[model samples]
Target: MRPVLIAGGGLAGHACALRLIEAGFEVELFELRPFFGGRACSYRLPGYGGSEIDNGQHVLLACCTALLDFYRRLGVEHWIRFHDSYYFLEPGGRLSELRPRKWAGPAALMAGFLALPIFDFRDKWAIVRGLAAVRRQAGDHRLDALSMEQWLERHAQPPRAVERFWRLILLSAANEELDRLSAYHGVRLIWLAFYGAPGAYRLGIPQVPLGSFFAEALWNRYGRLRRHVGQPVDKVLINGGRFHGFEVDRRVVEGSAGVLAVPYHRLAGLVPQLEADFSEWSCSPITNVHLWFDRPVTELPFAALLGRTIQWFFAERGGSYLKVVISASRQWRTWNREQIIQHTLEELKEYLPAVGSTTVAQAHVVKELCATFSPMPNLEARRPGPVTAIPGLFLGGDWTATGWVATMEGAVRSGYQAAEAVIRWLRADRGG
Candidate 1:
C-alpha cells in the first residue's frame, strides 16, 4: 500500500498520521519545519538561561481526553501534573482559593464559588443560574446564533461577574471576547471542564517542554510511520475534485489518500476549487512573558490575576522562573518588548509583593500573533469537517469543525475524525 500523505506536522497532522498507521495504513507525514507541535512548541533562548522555553504557555484540563490519549501514546502522560485547586489574586495581594469538596458532584464543584470573596450573593446566584442554563441547554442549536455576552445579559448576570468570571475564562479559552464569540462555543468550555467529570477541571500543566512529548525516537518504533521534516509541500494535487498527490519541491509525491492538516490560512491557496468564504476566520494573539527573579514570587504553582493585563502566571523550575500569559492580547501587540517586560513586573508587584523587592534578572517575551482561530458567532456552521468536497481529500485541523474551540483536544479529535473518514472511504472502495 502507498503511504498516505499528511501535510503539516502540527497536532492535527500528527494525530491523523498516527491513527492511520495504527489502523494498518502506511503513512508518510511531511512537516515544513524541523520540529512538530506548531504553535505549541519550544525553542532555546539566550536570555532564558539558554534553555528551551515554549513559544507560549499552553494549559490543558483533565477533560481533554483526546489530548490525554495522545500523550499516553507517547509515554509522556506522566510528564503532565494536574492541579486540583485554582488560586486567584487581586492587585492588593488578596488571595482566594477554588477547589472541589471531598465528595464529587455539582454542589462540591460549587463549593469553590462559595469561597470567592470577590462576588456578592446576588452575583453568585446569577452565576449559578447561568451555569444551570448551560448544563440544561448544552447542545441547543440556537446558542450558535447568539454571542456569549448577549446570553449572559439575558441570564441577568451582574456586570462584575460577567467581566471577572465569564469574560475572563471565555476569552482565555476560546481566544475571543464574549461579545464576539458564540454562546455555544464559550459555555461549552465551562460546562465540559467544570461540570463534566469529577476531576475534569483539574489544570494539567506539562512538566517538561511541549516538544519533548513528540520525541523523534517514538517515530522510529512504528515501521509504517515515515516523517519528512524540513520538506515543505508546494501544493495538494487535486484533479477533478479528487486528491491525486502532493507537489513537493517540484516533484510529485503520490499517495492513496491525503489529509490537508495545514493552518486555516493555507486552505484556500492549496485547493482553490473549494471556494468557501474564509473571511469570517481571523487569528487571535497570545503573549507570554518569561521572567526570572532573584527570589521566589509565590509558593503556589499558578494563580489568576484579577483586573490586570496579565491574566495568569505559572511558577516553573522551583518558583524562581515564571511564565505570565495574556490571552486574546490584541492591545499588547502594539507594545514593544521592553514595555511588556516592565508592565508585567509592575503588575506582578501588586499580586506578589516579593516581586516588588526583587531585581537583577533578564527576561524574554513570546508573542504569538496568530495563535488560534477566533471562535466567532456562527463559525460552527462555517467550519468544514473532515470530508471536503474533493474525494479522498480529508481536512484536519483545530480550525476544522471538531465541536471544539481550537484547543489541543480539538486538533487531535479532528485528526481522528479524518482518519475514520478515510478508513470508511477506503473500505467502501475495497468492498470490505
Candidate 2:
C-alpha cells in the first residue's frame, strides 16, 4: 500500500498518522516547522543561561481521555502530574482553594465553594443554583446559540460572582471571554467535568517541556510511519476533483490518501474542494511572562491570580522561575515587551510579595496571536467535518467539528475521526 500523506505536524496530523499506521496504512507526515507539537510545542531562548521554555503551558484535565490516550501511546503518560486542588489568590493576597470534599456529587463541590472566604452566603447560594441550572440544561441544543455571559445573566448570577468565579473558570477553558463564549461549551464543561464526574476536574500539568513528546525518535517507534520536518506540502493534487497526492517542495508525492490536518486558516488554500470558510472563525491569543529571580519567590507549583491581567502562574526550579499566563490576551497585543514585563512585575507583587524584594535574573514574554480558534457563540456549527467533496482527502484539526473546542483533546479526536473516514473510503474504493 502506498503511504497516506499527511499535511501539518501539529497534534491533529501527528495523531492521524499514528492511527492510520495502526489501521495497516503506510503513513508519511510532513511538518513545516523543524520540530513537532505545533502550538503545543516548546522552544528555547538563546543565551539567558541556555534554558529551554515551552512556547506556552498546555495543561490537561482529568477528563481529557483522548489526550491522555495519545500521551500513553507515546509512553509519556507519566510525564503528567495531576492535581485535584485549584488555588486562587485574591488581589489582597488572600488565598482560596477548590477541591472535593469527603462526600461525593454536587455536595462535595458545594462544600469547597462554601468554604471560600471570597464568596458571601448570597454568592454561594446563587452559584449553587446556577450550577444546578447548568446541569439541567447542559444537553439543551439551544444553549449553543447564547453566550456564556448571557446564560449566566439569565440564571441570575451576581456581578461579582460571575466576574470572580464563573468568568475565571470558563475563560481559561474556552480561551475566550464569557461574553463571547458559547453557553453550550460552558455548561458542558461544568457538567461533564464537575457535575458528572467527581475527579474529572483534576488539572494535569506536564512535568517536562512539551517538546519532549514530539522527539523524532518517538515517531520512529511506529515502523510504518515516516516523518519529514521542515517539509511543507504546497498543495493537495487533484485531477478532475479526484484526490491524488500532495505536492511537496515542488515535487509530487504520491499517496493512497491524504489528511489535511493544518490550521483552519490554512485549509482552504491547500485543498480548495473542501470549500472551508473561516470567515466566522477568529483567533485567540495567549501571552506568557517568564520571570527568573535570584532567589525563590513562592513554593506553590501553580495558582490563578484574581483581578489581574496575569491569569495564572507556574513555578519551577525552587520557585526561582515562574511562568505567568494570560489567555484571551488581546489587550497585550499593543504593549511592547518592556511594558509587558513591567506590568507583569507589578501584578506579581500582589500574589508573591517576595518578588518585590528578589532581584530579577531574566525575563521573557511570548504571545501566540493565533493560539487557538476562539469558541464564540455560533462558531461550533460553522466548523467543518472530516469528510470533504474529494473522496480520499480528509479534514483533521482542532478546528473541525469534533464536538470539542480548539484543544489538544479536540485535535487528537479530529485526527482519529479523519483517519476513520479515510479508512472507510479506501475500503469502499477497493470494494472491501
Compare the candidates by lDDT and give the number of the best one. 2
**Candidate 1 segments exceeding 4 Å error:** none
lDDT of 2 by residue, 252-287 (tens): 998888898999888878977667678888999999
lDDT of each: 0.86, 0.87
Over 183-221, each residue of candidate 1 has an lDDT whose tens digit, in order, gives 988878888866787778788999888887667877678
TM-score against truth, every candidate:
0.97, 0.98
Backbone collisions counted per model: 0, 0
- Model 1 clashes, total count: 0
